[model samples]
Target: MSGKLYLKDKLVDEELDLSMMQLTEIPVKEIEQLGSKVLKLNLSHNLLTCVPANLPLLTQLTSIDLSKNQIVELPENFGQLTKLKSLDLYSNQISKLPVSFAQLKSLKFLDLKENPLVPELAKAAGPCITANDCAKGFF
Candidate 1:
C-alpha cells in the first residue's frame, strides 16, 4: 500500500500525519527511519487490520490515532507504548483488549465507544471517555 507521508504543518519531525493514506500496513521502516524525532503519529481512517508490533520502538510517541479502521486486534505488545497519553480506537472490530493492555500506565484518554466488545471486557473498560467517570475501568 503506497501512501503519502507528510510533515505536520511546519516541517518539523515532532509530528507526522499519515492519516487517510489507505494503507494496508504500517510503514514501519519509514517510521523507524524517522526515529525518536516523532512525538505523534496519526494512522487513522485507513485499511489496517493489524499494526506491526515493532511500532512501540518509536518511544517518543505521545499520542496515536487508530480510529475508524478495520483493525480487529492490536499487537500483543501494543501496551508497551508507555509514553502514549491519548489513544483513539473508536469504531473498530476490537472485542477484547490484550492482557498486556494494563501496561499502558501513562494513557490518560481512551475512546472505546462504538466497538462490539465482549460484554465483560466492555464493562471492565467502561466508556473510558473521561477521566472522572470512566477512569477506573481503563485497562
Candidate 2:
C-alpha cells in the first residue's frame, strides 16, 4: 500500500510494471493520474486475491499480466477493456470466467495455463500455450 505511487518504466512503451510489489490491490488513483500514459499493466507475482473492482476504469489498457498471483475472480464487467489484446492469467486460482468475458472482442493473445478451469472452459480452451491457441476460448 505504501508503494501506491511507485513507478517503474517496465522497459516498454506506455507500460507500467508493478510486478512483485507485494500489493494486495492496485493503486487505481495513482495509475489514473498517469492517464492514458499507461496502456499496459503488469501485476504478476503479488498477493492479489481478486482483480481490482475499478480496473475496468482503465479502459486504455491494451494488455494485462495478472499471472502468479492469488486471483480468484475478475470484475463482472471485465470486458470493459475492449482495447485489451493480450491477457496473461497463468498460475492463478481462477476457476471460472465471468459471462462478460465473451465481450473482449479485441483480445488476440490469452494465457490461462495452470488454472483449474471448469469442464466447459477446458473443452473450449484446448491446449492453451501459444498465443493463437490460448485465444481460442474467449468467444
lDDT for 95 (candidate 1): 89
Q: Please report how far candidate 1 places residue 38 from its true position, in Å.
A: 0.7
Candidate 1 stretches greater than 4 Å from native: 1-13, 128-139
Q: Local distance difference test, per candidate?
A: 0.78, 0.84
Against the true structure, candidate 1 has what lDDT? Answer: 0.78
| Residue-level lDDT tens digits of model 1 in 44-131 | 8999898788887777789888888888888888878889998888888888888777888899778778888999978776765565
Q: Compare the candidates by TM-score and give the number of the best one.
A: 2
Candidate 2 positional error at 129, Å: 2.1
Clashing pairs in 1: none
lDDT tens digits by residue: candidate 2, 21-48? 7889878788888889899899999999
TM-score of each: 0.83, 0.89
